[model samples]
Target chain A: MVLGGLIGLAGCALFPLLWMLSVSLMPPGAADTLPPPLLPQHPTLANYRVLFAQDGMGRYVFNSLLVASVTTLVSLGLNLGAGYAFAKLHFVGRERLFQLLVGALVLPAQVTMMPLFLLLKWMGLVNTYVGVMAPMLVTVFGIFIVRQYARSLPDELLEAARIDGAGEGWIFLRVVVPLIKPIMVTLAVFTFLASWNDFMWPLIILTGQEHYTLPVALAALSREHAQDTGTMMAGALVTTLPVLVLFLVLQRHYIQGLLLGSVKG
Target chain B: MRPQRLTGWLFAGPALAVMTVFFFIPVLGGLALSLTDFDPYALADWHNLRFVGLGNYLVLLERPAFWSALGNTLYFVVAGVPLTMGLALAAALLLNHRLARWQGAFRTALFAPVVTTVVAAAVVWRYLFNTRAGMINVALQAVGLQPVDWLGNPRWAMPTLILFAAWKNFGYDMVLFLAGLQAIDPFLYEAARLDGASAPRRFWHITLPMLAPTTLIVGLLTVAGYFQLFAEPYVITEGGPLQSTVSVLYLMYDDGFKWWHLGMASAIAFLLFALIYAVSFMLLRLARKRGAA
Candidate 1:
């Protein structure tokens, strides 16, 4: 009985998302009825048609994909280097600098939005993809996660590589990179998911509708088409499905990253 | 070993530069901006700016909008955090059960929401709670209850958003609690069972105390997260049904981005930062004291 109840609760957890998919396939206005339809009686893709062909959701999808990909790739490289450095390399004030970065984590990102916007505006980056992707290019958490994982690298192995006459850059590229592959995958998945789902910063920085990412564009669409439930669900599905699938595919690494960053850190 | 100082700097410099220029500098600038009347006119011409020296903050203290937003945010954090944590704990406990079937699938199902875009999830939830046509109301009426104006009613709007937030967010803490649960030694529970302790007794004495550290971490994370309630109200109710759902971040967005009141918005941001920092600091202190005791 207990197990059955728990299973039902898990079903409840997935119900809204499943319902969203169901409603998105419904013909417009079919969902707005008493004793509301559980599944579309006549499933159609007209709402999606409207979204892509007319509402220009395709552009937003492209924008989201472009921004998230850039963020993941660039951030992975920068965070990997810095994180590995903090973990193994000897330097003056290395601990102090890492501590400073950790302290900065306590300050909320929202506190910087006003001035950051102004600064971006000064540099003519506001409403551009670069503006949308700038602040996230190197996150403190990313660095922290990478540092935590990189610390587990065997010091003897690094010393062996160094004694064999491998230069620091070559050692990082050939040795450390290969060793930290698991954390790298974890960080990539984490970064991509976060960058894809990020709304507030993109919403703030990208003012032009043409420049808008999926979430921002979806928000704008919802405000304009509050009554158009089918189209709205279609938008939601498009915005969420990629990350959902990505999470499902990379579940282990994603969960590992979560526990590593929170519990152990 | 040689001090690879230059190599280390070379590796770290780019990231440090990004953080310093983008994050740190802007934070310092935000403080300076908060002290001055930085508005649209100031944006247009530098000479239009005037040093206000706490004038914006003084005005915010008297503004009804600021107070209402603060109250709404506090309400969200207080109610939403407990609901999210309770549901998370319950789900984690259930998933942690020895008899639980397909634990991986169930865990993934429970955690799916954490990955979805908040604006998208909020949009989906807004439709689900529609008064006349929504599944929730349909189920309510099926159960012989009156349909609620979930978004349209002033009193109901916040509660609806709370429910939406808990559903969307509980998975995150569930994962945390699961980790916490697994970390506990099973021998304690075995001993409790051997000693004639009932399930409830075991839970109260063994489980709750053992989960205290995890509870503190989860509590701090949830509180800090819930305090920044914006996207749900922004997408679901537009902070509406008479501004009943206006959050501090929403207010900051309106003041800073919408109305171009950069100074006032910076003050709001700083206030929110200070509030979150204070609360988190307190939680950490409280947790340390408990640990010491």
Candidate 2:
């Protein structure tokens, strides 16, 4: 029964993806015909070629990569620093401050989006990548994950470094970072995937076609070319394939990072 | 002061500064903006801004679109959350069964939708759900079932969105529940079996109790997350078929960006915040009534 249910349910979950693959390969106007083709009669690379060369998908891809990577690098540093401090450092109002920060999680991101946009406009960052990336550079959830994982790091390691005449900066760079590298990787994957897939921020902030990330670009394209199924499907495949491949390859870390911050954390 | 005591600030200062400037400030600023009569004109000229305390909220309450958005969001939450949870629980149980094979493959397939780009997925589904030439309609015709216009008809639009949401989300919850299920003591099940209890009874008394906390967390998260529905409809239907799919967040997005009514949009945002906050607390209260998480 589990096997039966498994195939049936998983089939339902994956059917659209398969359909997308099939239709994307179909000849132009094929999917629009009666009893739309289940499989492409003659598969071709024409749509993908058109997307990359003519439609300027290469630019969107580059923009997504640049934004996601930069966000990941910056967030990894900031979140790790703050999380390590909360976990291992002794400070006045430490617990209270951590609690205050954690409490901010309940306020959804949408609540601040409008004002954030206005703020960006004032700062002359509007329509720039910086504007799109600023709001998500560090998340409360990201900090929580680092803090939770870092709490388990043995105190003796930090204390030993301190006893050896190492300063706080040296201790963090030499000891804390290496010890918590796994969590850093998890956070990196999480941030990178999120930044890559994020639509609304880029859609709102990226005013010009030249600046649009893949997801935002695809959304705009879909609206304009709703009649062109093959072209849109090709666009969808390009938008989805990177993250899908990343998840497939590093699914262990991706799923682990998610579960660490969420279910048990 | 001890060096460690001061280093906390040194380490935490950057993150604190970023969050304060980007997140905390905007939250407070959104509240202030909600109290005013700011719009595109105000964006262009600061002098046009007027302090109209509660006026935006009042306007929102009077707007037919706002009520429709709230109703649509409520329908989604009431319908989508339960269906997603139900499917997740069922799938988790099936995968958790000792008799199940190739569980990992099944798990990955089910969870694939969660990571896929929403816009991309919506593109795929929009085609599959096309009014006349959709593959879904073709399949229905093959099966001798009537083909309904999934996204073009107001009655079916929201439901189709709900279905897409559940399909996309249930796997993440299923993974959570599977984790919860694994943590349950097998000895309890053994004891129940020895006592001649049926599988249904074991599930009712043991499985349900063991999963209460997981269920609570998942429920609260799902409810809160579902309230912010924007991407799917924005991508697939564009809140069309006469606006049946316009969620609260979608409405906020339209008002805020499309019309540049930051004041009204901020009010809608706060109202959404209040709603999700209340719903979260209520879910927690409901969970605690049966048992603690």
Model 1 spans with C-alpha error above 4 angstroms: B1-3
Worst 10 residues of 1 chain B by lDDT: B284-293
Q: Which candidate is the best by lDDT?
A: 1
Model 1 lDDT tens row, B132-162: 7888988988899998999999999999999
> What tens-digit string does per-residue lDDT give for candidate 2 at B1-293?
58778899999889989999999999999999999999999999999999999999998889999999999999999999999999999999999999899988999999999999888999888888888988888888899999998998999999999999999899889988998899999999999999999999999999999888888888888888899999998989999889999999999998999999999999999999999999888778887787756
Error of 1 at A260 (Å): 1.7
**What is the docking quality class of candidate 2?**
high
lDDT of 2: 0.89
What DockQ, between 0 and 1, does each candidate earn? 0.80, 0.81
